[model samples]
Target: MMHPLSMPELPSGIARVQFEPERVDYAAPEASGRQGGVQAGWPLWLATFELEKVDRDSADMWRGFIARLRGRQRLFLASDPTRLYPKAAPRGFAGMVRAGGGAFNGSAIAWAQNVDADGNADIGLTGLPEGLALSVGDFIGFKWDATGAAAGTYGRRTMARVVIPGVVSNAGAVTVGIEPPLDMLVVPAGAIAHLDRPACLMRQIPDRSSIGSIGTGGALSGAVLVAGQDLRP
Candidate 1:
């Protein structure tokens, strides 16, 4: 297996970052021509990194990073620039991830999918401070399995975005909606919800990546679209 490459943050950072879920399905044409579809694969993320227009040095730096990627031949770790922390006071729990500080015990103490044991969009996060809530669009990450193996988590870390708004209960638990449900083949267990540094393993789309001077002078504007590598547990 090829090792995944770690990429530096863009020199000029990103002018924009767009995220979308990629769902695959097979069309099941109905007798009356009303189309029905069967899901073909688990959901994954499609991302677009809009490189900011910048000075020659910055443009060159962008070229250097893109060049190292060699256009879709390698994998890199990427995350939503807008989702480094939750949208609330204190914002995150990584710093105080312990018995006294916060709920981040790191042993997957209290984490599981909600409503359905098999797997779904909703997940239950335990060990949070009472009334602590995650807003829609906030991100969380976790991976778990009965055997406590990466094999159950599609062999990699998975990041998910909250889709429904909710608050933690007095018991320090809350259930919220998430998109692109983590691929959990067996019942999920020994799980922990991460509120910091959520990221996706991605491959650049060669055809969609381009960079060069786009306006007057030596300034450059560029963009690249990366797709999450679909994995099955």
Candidate 2:
């Protein structure tokens, strides 16, 4: 797992990050009844980041990062550096980088992350974090430690969206419902499960004018960046 403190090699001008919830709603009218509306399942998330005063050196760095990404690569995102999860069980949004570019002057750049773009996987586990309550829309992380008989089936770090919410069963097990089922049949026993609120995928829409300024003297002048989410097969 990559260390959270280790800065991701992204554009240099990123200054702030923001998150938005994604939801779908439907309304219907009956011949003899009032209109009714229904909200879909748990809300997915979107993230946005702001870049400020990107300079020429930063522009080159941004270009290099973008080139490496190839326009839709799945990468882990750490919105908060201080709140990073443990190396053994890192938790964050698994997303793909969207295709975007800055102005000719390289003053600013816009980027976005889509949570549902990658979809989810269904996983069943034998243990539940004691006294922990899970709800729909909560963000969870799954880690398959390289141990146990089923270790080879599970991979490293993966994130998912909770689709069904229920209590721990009498058998001392909790069946987690996630979108997009896990590729393997069984998760390693005692695999790490992380629960966190305020976690989501991010995407930013920057002002085009912010990318038109050229650096003067040795001062940085604008920003550029790209981001995306990993879609499930």
Candidate 3:
């Protein structure tokens, strides 16, 4: 019954990727000891795909995506395996997809009037379609569901990664700057935010050297995969 997975249309021999953010450094003890570590929760997004030259059908499709992530009960929505999109946009995700006709920020409802912890905020856009652009590692997806909702229970999904970068201010505002923050507690302006491919909702830990095939001309390499340890569902 584990038939609820997504995000796995990436295959190209993967050269080198490393999506970041993997916190939980707590270590502020005292009594004559260590005292310099903070970040304590909500920081899980780690990708590290690294497939070298490939062949043999891209090494059997990267070992069939590391055997369908079965070593960890398969869940999906991973990203940044060298970036999924929004790195300059420019008609990429259809340049925000709907403009004069509405629905760019999903029917003009993308919001975020307040947010801080590190995941800065200021996204209140409208139909943007004039050569889109959002920089700094791009990756966005916050929710409380509003326009065209779907993440049941009123959406609790939240993903971030832009480190401060902006544009699109001809009215359809823009002032993003996210990080490891914005996961609810109060992000309700009805809350909504979306940028093409911002992902992170994972479960993986493949092994068996991850992948294989490295001889007889069909060169291949490890198809490593790792997530935030085990954040369970």
Candidate 4:
């Protein structure tokens, strides 16, 4: 099985993502009446995200995140919703985020309710109403709670190994059996967990809008920022 390239979670704010191909076609008179085409360039993938209430903290965080990128930094991007737990190849791509965008946005917030570290413990999670659609050998990202006493000793951020396939159990549980059986720290109750996937380095577009007024206080209300794949020949 082709494993996904381990990558950090996408910054919160992305509400939707899209993939597009950059191609060109031409016909050579001498070659015949048949038409041939070659890839104009690498495929272009775009991710759209929104900035919540637009608070100072959120705004600063977004600004810092982008500023740190310096417009051409390589970053991992995984926006495919269908292949959350890819079983075969084509796990994810490595690209650069196009520059020229100044839209401010934050990351998503999620947490797990309970966890166990037995031979193959089942973990329960919250904020995932649709449950998870995962396969064996997939990876799950976890951020240990800062307040947890063991946070200092154990790695705060780590990936969990998925031992079983299929969606989360009817009780909203997923089974994990860490490979190598290292003395892995148990993810305490209320820790954050997210789906993991391989990522390709991408460049952030420098063109973006300034912080704007907040819209309705609905869950879907926020600003949309776009990032494109940075292709290199």
- Candidates in order have lDDT scores of 0.66, 0.40, 0.59, 0.40
Tell me the lDDT of model 4 at 166.
Answer: 49
lDDT of 4 by residue, 1-233 (tens): 11122222444444444433223435444456766544343234454455555545455556555555555453434444434533532343223111222221111133332334443344443333233455665555544433434433322333444565545444444444432121234444444455534222245565752333444442323454445543321
Best by TM-score: 1
Q: What is the clash tally of candidate 4?
A: 32
Indicate whether candidate 2 or candidate 4 has the larger TM-score: 2
RMSD (Cα, Å) for all candidates, in order, is: 4.6, 14.3, 15.7, 16.8
| TM-score of each candidate structure, all chains considered together | 0.76, 0.40, 0.33, 0.35
lDDT per residue (tens digit) for residues 119-229 in model 3: 456454555555466788777765453235455533234467777777666555576667766545444556456675556556676542366457777777665656542
lDDT of 1 by residue, 1-233 (tens): 44456555532557787877788989899999798778887778888877766676666677777787888777776777777667873345644444334556322247776546644578787666666668998888764332444444433556788998788776667789888677766324544566766666778887876764445665677655555554423
TM-score of 4: 0.35
Best-to-worst order by TM-score is 1, 2, 4, 3
What is the Cα-based lDDT of residue 113 in candidate 1? 67
lDDT of 1 at 149: 48
77: Cα error in model 1, Å: 1.1
Assess candidate 1 and give its lDDT.
0.66
Estimate candidate 4's alpha-carbon lDDT, on a 0 to 1 scale.
Answer: 0.40
Candidate 3 regions with alpha-carbon error over 4 angstroms = 1-10, 14-20, 29-46, 50-53, 56-99, 102-113, 117-123, 128-138, 141-213, 223-233
90-160 per-residue lDDT for model 2 (tens digits): 44323311123121111112111123344544445334322233455444554444333244343343345
Q: Considering only N, C-alpha and C atoms within 3 Å, which residue pairs clash in candidate 3? A: 103-107
Backbone clash count for every predicted candidate, in the order shown? 0, 31, 1, 32
